[model samples]
Target: MTVYLEDEQQFFEKHLGLLEKVEAVINQCLDQEEVPYEVEVSLTIVDKAEIQEINLEHRQIDRPTDVLSFPQIDPECIGKINWDNLDTSSCVNYDTEEIILGDIILCDEIAALQAEEYGHSLEREVCFLVAHSMLHLLGYDHMTEDDEKNMRQKQENVLQCLAILR
Candidate 1:
């Protein structure tokens, strides 16, 4: 997994360790799932105003969201894909570079608010959001009860692997 971070807001302090941990979580999830394809993900950090604009444009909500994922996977990637089993190491050929994923947008302001509301550290909230977004990029959704349960379980598993579970 390759994460390109664009910090458009100075709201939260730039912590490399935290960013690294989030990337590790993404990578761990990918490896654990045994995806036999390389992926490149972008993380754009924005303030309330920027995220609100994005939310309005993309979702027409006119409000800030915790995170948003723009997936690049296709119908074949989902329908004919055997997600149950894969070989992680065989996914990527380091000699010839290839990109497999897309971008993710995160709202720093909303994340801060959620952390305060959930009574947890900012790091935990951000990590959780990252994990959630990663799942979205991996063809996971929470639009229904069963989907929500499965996605939540995947999130918890990734977080637990990183020892970030509550």
Candidate 2:
């Protein structure tokens, strides 16, 4: 797995080993889901204003969000993607030959606030957000009751696998 992580904030304080842990968590998700190819995901950390603008533009909701996922998987393939027979032309990078999974945009300000509010380290909160967005990229959504339950359980399992605690 290749993760292109960009922290847009000017004064971001990064935790040691955060990127390593994040990469591990993402690989764990793909392993658990049985994805059969190498993948590349882009992650960006932005400020409050940028997130709100993105939320408005993409979701039509004028509000800042914790994280946003833009999945590359076709809608028709959602919940039914054939791992063994993915179409390389549509889903892969020509140069890298890695599956283009998706993009994740995280609000650094909101993550910090939520971390303080939830009484957990900023690292844990950020990892949780990453895991959540990863699930979305994998075509899992929490739109319905059962879906929400399943997504939550899967998120917890991924976190637990990495020993990332709340």
Candidate 3:
């Protein structure tokens, strides 16, 4: 997996250690899920205001959230992608031969606050958010109670596998 990370907010500069850990969490998720295609994910860290504007524009949610995921492929397409028959010759960046997974936007301000509220380090909170967003990118959703439970369990397991406990 290739993670193209950008920090639009300066908050992440102080917590540089968390960035590496977050990337590892994403990679671990993809590997554990046995994703057949080489994947590329874009991750951006923003402040609360920036994330709030994005949330409002994209999701019609006026409030800021810790993380948001925008998937590139349809949920059904994700499951049906034929890795063996995939013709990467026409795809952009075919040299890398990676399927563009999607984008993950994270709110550093919210993450920091949640870390304090949840009584955990910022590292853990960021890792959790990354893991959660990675699942979303992979067509996971929490619209129903059962679905939410399953997604939550998956996120916790991924975090645990990385030894990123609360």
* Candidate maximizing TM-score: 2
lDDT of each: 0.76, 0.86, 0.83
Look at candidate 1 and tell me the lDDT of residue 73: 60
After superposition, candidate 2 runs with Cα above 4 Å error: 10-13, 75-78
TM-score of 3: 0.89
Q: Per-residue CA lDDT of candidate 2, range 28-99, in tens?
A: 889888888899999998998999999999999999999999998854443556666667788889899999
For candidate 2, the lDDT comes to 0.86
TM accuracy, model 1:
0.84
Q: What is the lDDT for 62 in model 1?
A: 86
Taking all chains together, each candidate's TM-score versus the true structure is 0.84, 0.93, 0.89
- Model 1, runs deviating above 4 Å: 10-13, 75-96
Which run of 10 residues does model 1 get worst, by summed lDDT?
74-83
Q: lDDT: which is higher, 2 or 3?
A: 2
Clashes of 2: 0
Over 1-166, each residue of candidate 3 has an lDDT whose tens digit, in order, gives 7888888776567876777798789888888777777788999999889899999999899999999999775565433444456555543357687888889999988989999999999899889998999988877888888888988888899999989998
